[model samples]
Target chain A: MEVQLQSWQNMKLAQVPHMLAGHAMPWVLAARRSAFERFAAHCFPTRREEEWKYTDVSIIGRRSSLAPDHIPPDPSSEAKLLAWTLASESLYLMVFVNGHYAPGLSMTDDLPAGVRMASLANILENGADLPESYFDPQHEHTIFAALNNAFATDGMVLDLSPGTVLKAPIYLLYIASGHGVAIYPRNIVVAGEDAQATVIEHYMGTLDAHNFTNAVTQISLSAHAEIEHCKLLQEGPAATHVAGIHAEQASDSHFISHSFALGGRLARNDITAQLLGKSCHCTMNGLYLLNERQHLDHHTRIDHLAPECISREYYRGILDGESHGVFNGKVVVHPGANKTDAHQANHNLLLSRQAEVDTKPQLEIFADDVKCTHGATVGQLDDDSLFYLRSRGIDAELARSVLIYGFTNDIIGRVNMPELRTRIEHLVLERLPQGDQIKELL
Target chain B: MLTIKNLHVSIDDNGNGKEILRGINLNVKAGEVHAIMGPNASGKSTLAQVLAGREGYQVTAGSVRYLGQDLLAMTPEQRACEGIFLAFQYPVEIPGVSNALFLKTALNAMRKQHGLPELDAMDFLSLVRERMKRVGMDEALLSRAVNEGFSGGEKKRNEILQLTVLEPRLAILDETDSGLDIDALKLVADGVNDMRSPERSIVLVTHYQRLLDYIVPDVVHVLSQGCIVKSGDANLARELERHGYSRVETENTAKQVA
Candidate 1:
């Protein structure tokens, strides 16, 4: 084991001390050292692994040189962020530029009492005390998450006290700029009993910038707490994004996750939910609109470890051009977890002949009294639907656009926030050929 | 306003064409309501689909003319743009698209086709609100997906709603009374009767003469074995209803010579 990864391991280990954030705090430094060691020990997950069977992460492994920028927001990138932040005034915005928290651009007006929001990097630099067990040593299930944990410079550490609920959503915006730049943004949320809120994690890069964004968000909901976690990846066209979302729901808590992957040359997301207590409900819904040569893969797992837990996973992909999409969702009902209900579905619509999708829905049920159902489909637009639209004076192209938009509405409609829903609707429409005309119809 | 001369349509299966509509001839003038009554598999619905230019139907022979133009040469949307409407027997349920948006898009598309300015959302909604109320289509359904989870009667009412909103010149009602109840049937029949005008021609295709009892047709044509075997005044529909198609079985395949 010493010689197996001595040189490569040392090379990656060198990035620990040089990481842009979390250096001043010894606990953070220790956490980073262990995470980097673990990441290097495993190298990068390959096709041999069951989870990474379809995706090839060799490109990321080669480009994983940690050169995160510690610079402030540029005028142009700030302008673009300002436009978005202004558009969603109802959301508390946390802005991060080049993996470091941007205090100038971050907005937290009207923050309620008992709600704690702070920059993890600042907390570590100031030598603040973190919540107990905040840094889970074994939570990094994949190399990407480990890498993020090790190389992450700055992140949002949100603490919602028990019985405290925010009426507005909390938006975390991470912007990366620079050629071949790699930025890791990690987020942690701790909600006490009966606490509820919606959090939007959006990762974007400057136009035409080549970058890699590896992000991880760990959320724990207390009893009766509800949290809607939305992850939107809109990086540059030449960018690569890898994200891991790990959530733990207590008894009677509700957790909803929506992953909208529109930009980036290659984007992969691993979303895992642990329903640890009884009567917890988790919903995982995602929509990916891919075009050109983009590639996206989503791997989701829902573990029902307690009795009477319900989990629903629905993911849809619309692929055009020569793009490829993949979705593998797994639902596991643990032993003796009776009365567990799990449903999983993944559907892909290929607009062009060359577009392709690989979809698989897995249900591993060890409990006899549990109910589990899974379905997957990869196909083109329904001819009947197209013809129906055309019969109403809508041309073939416009009809196709409307039907495609309609297919994605199932996921978008699940979002209760009007602003987020409209933004998602716009992105899905923007990928279609007749999007402009369809917009007028609405 | 519409004429079919020696029309034939077939569905291709394994490189073989099985004809559904044999050689047929018919003429429909403006402001006239013609009832095309036939038994199941009598090519009634196929004729309507072919008229609307739905794909999978290879027009093996014949020509259809509307307003002196080649009707068979247009596409489904083009046919709709040119003032032809076919209230589908089974309206397709399009999830995620609201009924109001569908109607607005269709109405604006037709208006744009006829060189008329498009209506804005407010004007369009106002126009739709009144017509939808007239057809008894609940205002709440306008926001719901098109025909998604709608009851049978509600679906029929939606069809009448579209018919009234579009206001086409040549309207073909294909089994519109199939799944509706007596009250719904009367409501739909009244909707159709209200739309009858001197500038428009209507075709009511039904398996029973029950629909004609509400909206009396000027002419009744009995289709058998893919051909109009019999044609007469409105009295013909009642005679065929009383005798049943078995009596008309003797008239099977007797092609009508126009």
Candidate 2:
């Protein structure tokens, strides 16, 4: 065990120089070096850690490597990948293949004014100051985040000017195309004062490969700005995904995050939002559907750093076969941050006895006058509800699917985008055990 | 259209089988409405549940025949598709499933079973709109989740709407008047009365005679200890209302002893 752990540390250290070999920018190289040092200083998390008690990352370390390699794109596979796009004329699509921007596949025509969108590599090569200021290497507390910062090849950089509102949504598509390769994707979004936009990050794997995706996203909202961000992970069955989202909201700003994880062998998502100004509001909603030995873990934290800030979070999970799910949510109200109102809830449904779930919802309040509430529940479908559906001429299997859909509808209903909601509803139903029967009902 | 002969039902209680319905016998012909009135805990609801093919009940003896088919052998959904409808005493709330979708699926299932074509969207809408007037249901209710956050009266009325759409050969109403007010009760009774036809049979199970006042039954059966003690006409319902259930219980006990 000791030798294996030592070799794991050495393996990560050896990849640092390879990560910064071709980078010419001093600041970018320094950032990578700092992130690699931090990653080397801390060992990979285990079940002993409180935050990782239910999830173990050793399998990821043993199976995935850091060295980057290119895979020739298959035209048929690329076409198959494009079929999953939102197929709407109003959508502004940005495509990334193997963590590098694919200009030929992107659609940037007719973009609204005051919107600056470019690849992260392009901005870095141009000596842009925005990427340097936004990327934080010292804040890497997790091994995956550290790895993402040190080795991220390319991602999307979106900037919205003050008072700018984009009528159409922006879609960022990340496709993993090769086997046994590790890809780091870094995305940054900055919305100026009174600006509003909706952005969706869709990660998919084109081949049935044993791959790993380590993603990091940073979002900053200026005063009175509002943004709706969505993250969807539907990788190949043999893929492992780990993602982190960090958001900061200014006074009177609103931020809503929606995450749906439906595929991958093992997946973990961590999100944190800091309400730094008065009257800022933040909402987080997530859903995970797993089956056949799949595992998913979600961790969310909301900090009320100023007075009159509000936070609401609700996450749900459905596990079938031998799958497992984990949920951990926390809401914190710092001192002097009075008038903070926060609500958090986590619900899980297990379709089989072999399926399991662990949930923890917590509220830490230091302010004297604050309203914070959190709850967690894990159970199966209501037998009465199932019988009710069966009594109305639906078969037992179809009835079970209907009840499961009903369980997830609570979270899906929170989606404000009708087309996206409908698409998600269809995807969720298609993943159900008896999905065919439920399709007619939907 | 329906026959029940010496039906006995029992349920598992702490690993011991406890009999809820000792023996029940009933027969109804086409175009007839039968009222089975009994006091509480006299197996009134059990009989309705047994006929509807609900689980958790073991039929120790007897049989039920509907249209010359073995009713007890079929599943709940199968029985439903074969024209058996039960208006629950306490309707279960199913969230996220719209009422219109529920009815449409059920109606299509029944129609397919009877070798008939399914109703399309336009035809289904018109049919439901015409039936909505019978129970005075709001058009918006059709789009809402089935019985979710619905008032007691509204839930009962929704059941009536389902019955009207399915057009079942045998309809069983189990204490449908329990939670309804006078006006709502009148509306429900009118809905039941509107469904009466030469090819349909109705069964009304109630504790009070008020529901019978609006939709009078051709035959009234007094059930005591899960056995029908007396059978009479519509006047018997009024007489029972005047005399109360205690008098009938005493007479039933006396007759059993003799």
Candidate 3:
């Protein structure tokens, strides 16, 4: 609880002096007036708050005390950051530096006929936008998201025409290179009726620069529309990340979101999916691997607001060294949402004796006729399985490494995108302590 | 080629222990198959586990020599590299790993330990295809996760396929015939028979004589109270099948005096 005050009262306002002197145009400054006011009224949440009890952001706030510098990153470091991308021939790559759209690093080709990809600045300047009804306050549940809304400079926007089938996926990469800085980025996606596309948001750092990234993404899918959204978080070690994703699925629409967390000193993701139309389906899957003194948290909510909607969620974590992981998933079925089917599961594998995992899967059903189940498991590797492999001539240490890889690989393998799947596999393998043992595996 | 001298094993870490493998002695040379048959609670499986160097069993007194080398002194992988294989009654399911890939890694590990070239993908494919046909396994099974969602028969067949790929000099099958139908038993037996060679040895541990009917052993040993009380040709298996294990144990005591 003491840590909460440090992160909120002191660190939240420390950057105000530095930010006020920062450069911005008159029109852009005018646009952010309301956002800055909203941020001032609502500060960071304390540990006493039920939603933030398990995760203390005070450590992150202390780290964010140093103001972010606007100086662009070096060319060599930018090349290294782009090297981690696994984009394919059909992907339209959009790159960002210091949370601002970087046109020089981005590549645009093979775009669909009725699809638009533009920066938030351009959208604001040209007056293009999503329906006003889609915008809602999510920061009431997460104070960091409100901070992101308050400081967001610019972001990416996607607009699809009805009945358009995108042949290639859109790749959005976010890079941070400044030292002791904070960057807020936002992404808005709208899928017209009967449209289908896949979007990949990748995060990486150009240098070992100490920084903070606060991001918010809002997605709205029309009836009969489908969207596959995947986020990859592989930030720098000294960095802190706070991200929130809000998705609204209409009747006959399908939305799938996959989050892979493998970065930062402290990271937390808040994901919400609201099924507002009948026969809608939403699947949320996530995998997190942490080591060193890192802390990672995931809070997911699925609201079954309409009848006959189905939702499935599975989140897995592997904590090593002195790391900590937390999972809090809740499925809410409102009244009159009969025939709703929802399932949530969280599984954690603790590698070291000192590693810890806190998991809670909650299911609250108000409808009379609905099926809901939730379970959480935290345990070490199976001794029987390990012995089975050792008895076959594999060394005990190698056997443990293989089992660990196989455990997390199940979730990574669930990704339908082939290139992205392979990239995540490589990243996961590289992050393991016994990465050398897996060279033979690949 | 294996020799066990006064082999004794005890379960549990307790120092004041009840010995599982009492003073037992056995010897077998190349070009022969030996079957160890016993009732439930007997130490037939313990003997196989000890020979494979699995943990959790304390060897109070014993020395085992395999092909003129100290078997118990070597690590599990070392024994594997030296051509020792165990076909488990219940194979472990390894998810997210393809059958072909798992086999290739195991095969290459053994090959590398033996100073041989690692088998490439095409070479492994050719080798697996032949083994699959002999085991009556569908070729498509190799692309799926190892033993995951596989039928009982398929799992057994997959075990046989791995055995064929490894081709160890000594194979100790720990109740491989425990869970199988008549057709599956025949297919598995055929796979074992095809693997038989003049320079290789086999030890089949089973509670029933059905497996011996297909792959007849050169010798059948009856293990009772952690010791071998009777040893004879394949006829011992048939007699025990007809008279039951209790009758055999009593008869062995009587024959000891005669």
Per residue, candidate 1 scores C-alpha lDDT tens digits across B1-258 of: 999999988988789998889987999999999999988998999999999989899998999999999998898999999889999899989999999889998999889888999999999999999988888888999999999999988988998999999999999999999998898899899999999999999999999988899999999998877888888999999999899987776755343232
lDDT of 1 by residue, A275-352 (tens): 999999999999999989999999899999999999999899999999989998988899977999899999888988
DockQ of 2: 0.66
Query: Which candidate gets the maximum DockQ versus the true structure?
Result: 1
User: In CAPRI terms, where does candidate 3 land?
Assistant: medium
User: TM-score of chain A, model 2?
Assistant: 0.94
**Candidate DockQ scores, in order:** 0.75, 0.66, 0.61
- The candidate with the higher lDDT, 1 or 2, is 1
Instruction: Output the TM-score of candidate 2.
Output: 0.96
lDDT of 1 at A1: 28
**Which interface RMSD values do the candidates have, in the order shown?**
0.9, 1.5, 1.7
**Interface RMSD (one decimal) of model 2:** 1.5
Kindly list the per-residue Cα lDDT of model 2 for residues B109-134, writing each as its tens digit: 67777799878888999999999987
For model 3, residues B61-152, the per-residue Cα lDDT tens digits are 97999989999898887888898888877888988767876787678778878789988778888988988998999999988887999998
The sequence of per-residue lDDT tens digits that candidate 2 reaches over residues A308-367 is 998999999999989999998989899989999999999899899999999999889899
